[model samples]
Target chain A: MKANKVLINTLAIAITFMTLVPFVWMVSASFMHQGEANQFPPRLFPETFSLEHYLRLFISMNIVRYFLNSVLLSASITGLSLLVNSMAGFAFAKFHFPGKESLFKLLLAAMIIPAQVTMLPLFLMMNQLGLINSYFGVIIPGMASIFGIFLIRQYISSLPDSLIEAARLDGATDFQIYWRIVLPLAKPILVTLGLFTFMGTWNDFMWPLIIMTRESMYTLPVAMANLSGEHSQDTELMMAGAVITVLPVIIVFLALQRFYIEGIMLGSVKE
Target chain B: MKGKRLFKVWMSPALFLAPALLLIAVFFFIPVVVSFLMSFTDFDIYSLADSSNARFVGLENYKNLLSDPLFWKAMHNTLYFVFIGVPLSLFVSLGTALLLNSKLIRFMSLFRLAYFLPVVTTLVAVAVVWRYIYHPSFGLVNYLLSLIGVSGVDWLGNPNWAMPALILMAVWKNFGYNMIIFIAGLQNIPPELYESAQIDGAGRWQELLHITIPMLMPTTIFVSIITIIGYFQLFAEPYVMTQGGPMNATLSIVLLMYQEGFRWWRMGYSAALAFVLFLILFAATLIQLHLQKRFSTV
Candidate 1:
């Protein structure tokens, strides 16, 4: 029994180390000076760490611009989506409009259709709207997603109806009730949904690759891809770029981890 | 009061649904419909200049797609990815979930974060990172393999290994998501059942086999279906890394659709490919639903 316990403990430790090693190695390699990473016997610790590549990325490559773009785009998408989807979610949860169930059912069915199917014509539509290569192009398609609405509605539905009724009885307008009452109560899921939207927008690659034509409009992911294409040989610099692109998301996830993990379970449990 | 009540009722839903419905219709639904229309017509470079140039070909693009060996190759490659990648990912996720949920495990959050790190990382960045990591000589993977006395294998350069390499990276990136879901399911399992099994003199293996697996069926189904849907939409990894090459071994349906739509300006043909993919996906979704229903009833 003692031997079995020892074996299980060792197995657990080994698995944890294996899971963490890639990320640890990535961070370690990012900090190492050029060519120091590819050393024989694989130095897990940097003999000489430097911020030269990071400085070069900011100075030479305009990586900060891409970072700003990711931030701006992700924030805009989140803020707008929260407003839009929260309203819709509130309605779906509380309001008894005709065809509410059918409208929602249709949206749920539409979820099965992959976003890629719409890419071709969405590109054309954006081009026609003079939105191509603009932030609006990327932001517009993602402004309101069915999943976002569904998530918000699920959370909103669980809230007691008597609260909203009380607001209505006290002469709060429908919008006022949503903003003042439901919104405050639904804050947790809103944060969860916002983080989800923000992370998704930040990490998105395909649509941005399609919509944003010029180098100037590129998000961090797109810029990283472009950088890899151009500077495939500069492994250290590329690692630095990867580090920059991935770091914000990791930080965000770590900071709001409780909400994020709960959000995942919530989303998965229903559908 | 009635007027105010009616206005409140109509306005709330309208205000709420309008934005999402509008965006979904304009950006998602309309474009999908437009793509369906586009698949039937000869929409190409000339059509971009003048819409009049696009003629209704009436399934010519579909016919051409059927005959195209490149499309077949892409289809074969995609199926290979779906079939192999789906089961492998499921197994890995289930394995990790089992390990993580084990009573002997400590520092669960630390391990969970480590496993899930790849899921949240930017795909382009990871692909770029993995491109180097799959580097035959300098790669971490090869370096580790060499410790076991195995020679370095050209992971990306070799056509045979290229898709498998992509599958490996993809699995590594994605398995954590399903693992989390499975962990939730595992945790949800009633502890009393396990205790009951223990009192019945059931061994660890028997308890897991009889108790855990049966309980996890619904979650397993959900994970597999979503994983399959996601695997079919493989685009960014190959786009960033291989551009669907060493002889199109890694070329996927979406990548092929992308080339035909954007790169070559064969929009109509690409639209056709998109519909066919949609059809295949629809079928897969139905199968998943069917399986779930069957399992539930049984």
Candidate 2:
């Protein structure tokens, strides 16, 4: 019994180390001087830690522009989606309206239809709207999502109805009830949805790859992809670029993980 | 006063729902319908430039897709990924979940967090990192292999090895997600059942095989179905890492669709490919549901 316990612990620690090795190498290699990563029997640690690669990424590769673009685009999507999805979610949860049940059901069914189905037409539509290569091109389609609305709806439904009713009885308008009562109460889910939207928009590759034609408009993922093709030899620099692209989402995820995990469970549990 | 109140009641919901509903209709539903219609037409670059150039050629794209070897290769590759990747991922996920759930483990959340870190990181970035890790000469993987007297093999460069390489990276990146789900499922299994089994002389293996697997069947089904669906849409890994190269060994169905749609401007053909993929996913889900029902009845 003791032997078995020892084996399990040893295996767990080994696997954890193996799992984290790539990320550790990514961070370490990003700080190494150029060409140092290409050495045989690859060095896990940088001999002399330097920020040259990071500096080059900002100055030479212009990764700062892509970083800023990702931040602006992701933040806009998150903010707008929170507002749009919360309103829809709140209405679905609290309002008595005609076609409410049917509409919500239709939206639920639509979730199965993969987003790729709409990508072609969305690109064309954006082209016609002259939104291609514009920030709005990326931001517009993501302003509201079915999953976002569904998540908010699930979270908002669990709140006590008496709260909304009391507010309503006190002469609060529908919007006022949502703004003053539901918003504060739904703060946990709002943060969850906000993190999800922000991370999703930031990590988005295909849509932005299709829509954003100009290099100047590219998000960090797209820019990194383009860089990989052009600068395949610069492993350290690419690592630095990867670090820049992935760090913000990791921070956001780590901070709000409780809400994030709760949201996942809420999403998975069939009502 | 009653009429005014009714008007306000009716308008409030509409006002609240208008923005989200309109966006979904215009950007999601309408585009889905348009894309489906587009599959029936010859909507190429010329059509894109001038709407008049597009002609309705019903079923032709799907027919061509049936005859296309590249499409079959893509299908084969995707199935290989789903079949192999799903099992491997589930094994790792289930294993880690069981380990973390073990009474002997300390700091379970820390271990869980470490494993899940890869799932949240940017795929494009991780794919780029893995590209280097698969580097023939100086890669961490090859270096480790060389330590055991196994000469370095070109992971991504060799056609035969490319898909497996991708599958490995994918499993590493994904197993954490299903691990969390499996942990929840594991927790739901009552400890009393285990205690009774222990008292009844049921060995660990027997108890696990009989008790744990059967109890976690529903969660297992859910995880596998989602994992299969997600794997079918493999794009970024190959796009960033291989570009579906080394003789198109890593060319996933979605990647093929992407090339035809965006890169080559065969929009109609690509839309057909998209529909084919959708149908496949739909059918797969139905089969799993059927299997789950059958298994539960037994």
Candidate 3:
């Protein structure tokens, strides 16, 4: 039994180290000087920790612009999606209307259709709307997702209907009840959905790559992809760009991981 | 009075649902419908410049797709990925879950988080990182291989190795997600079964075969279906790391569609390819569900 325990522990630790190697290498290489990351034996830690790559990324490559673009785009998508999805979710959970069940079912079934199917037409639509190369091109489609609505609706459905009824008895308008009562009660889910949206928008590549034609309009992922293409040989510089692109999502994920995991569990368990 | 009350009840929900429904209708539903229609027409770069240039080419694109060797190649690659990648991913996930769920393990959550870290990171960023890691001469992978007295192999540059390299990165990136699901599944299994099996002189492997595997079947199915669907849409890894390169060894259906639709502006043909992908996914999902039902009945 003792020998078995030792074996399990050893395996666990070994797997954990292997799992973390890429991230550790990414961080270490990002701090290495130009040409230093390409050295013989592939140093796990920089010989001299330096921010030269990050400095070059900021000053020469103007990654700050892409950074800010990512922030703006992700934030807008998160905030707007929260409001739009939450309102619909609340209605689906609380309000009664003709065809509500069928409508919800239709939306649920639509999830099977891959987003790639819509890309070509959506791009043409955006072109017609003069939204091509604009933040709205990305933000608009992201404003309301069926999955977000489903998540919020699932959460809100568990909340006591009497609360909404009580607010209704207090002469609150539907919107007011949703804004003043339901929104506050739904904070945990809102945060979960918000993190999901923010990270998704931030890390999104294909759509942003398609929509944002201009270099200035590029999100972090698209910008990073472009950098990889243009500077494939600059290992340190690419690592720096990778770090910048991935850092915010990681921070957000680590901080709000409780809700995120809860959200995943909630999603997996059929309602 | 009754009519007014009915109107009020309907209006409230409608008002709340309007924005989301409208957005979904316009941005999602309409585009899907339009893309379906567009697939029947010869919508190309010329059509982009002038809408009138597009002509109704009934099923020609699909017919051409049938004959296109590249399409077949992409189909083969995608099936290769889905078939091999799904089982490998499930095995890794199930293995990790079993290990992590072991009572003897310490700091399980920390280990879980470490394994899951890749799942949360941006794929494009990780792909770029992996690109460097696959570097032949100066890469960490080759360097480690050298320490083992194995000669450096060109990971991404060799067509034989490129797909496998992508598969490795993908398995590394994704196993944690299904691990979490499998962990949940494992926890749900009644411990009395294991104890009963032990009392019956059943060994560890026998207990796993009889109890754990059967119990975890639903979760396994769920994970497999989702993994298959996700893998079918393989794009970012190839786009970022190899660009379907080393002589198109890593070319995926979605990448081909992207190249055709966006890069070359062959909209109709790309839409046909997209529909074919959708068909494959739909069929695969149906077959899985059918198998699930069969298993449940048996």
Q: Top model by DockQ, which number?
A: 3
DockQ for each model: 0.70, 0.79, 0.83
Output the better candidate (1/3) by lDDT: 3
**Predictions in order: lDDT:** 0.89, 0.91, 0.92
Alpha-carbon deviation at A250 in model 1, angstroms: 0.3
What lDDT does candidate 2 reach at residue A184? 96
TM-scores of all predicted structures: 0.97, 0.97, 0.98
User: Model 3, range B112-154, lDDT digits (tens) per residue?
Assistant: 9988889899999999999999999899899999999999889
> What C-alpha lDDT, on a 0 to 100 scale, does residue A17 get in candidate 1?
75
Query: In CAPRI terms, where does candidate 1 land?
Result: medium
- Which residue pairs overlap in candidate 3's backbone? none
Report the poorest 10 consecutive residues by lDDT, candidate 1 chain B.
B7-16
TM-score-best of 1 and 2 = 2
Top candidate by lDDT: 3
Q: Which sequence of candidate numbers ranks them by TM-score, best first?
A: 3, 2, 1
TM-score of 1: 0.97
The regions of model 1 sitting more than 4 angstroms off are: A38-42, B1-8
lDDT of 3 by residue, A96-213 (tens): 8889999999998888899999999999999989999999999999899999999999999999989988988999999899999999999999999898898888889999999998
Clashes of each: 0, 0, 0
Candidate 2, A239-265: lDDT as tens digits: 999999889989988998887777667
Question: How are the candidates ranked when ordered by DockQ, highest leading?
Answer: 3, 2, 1
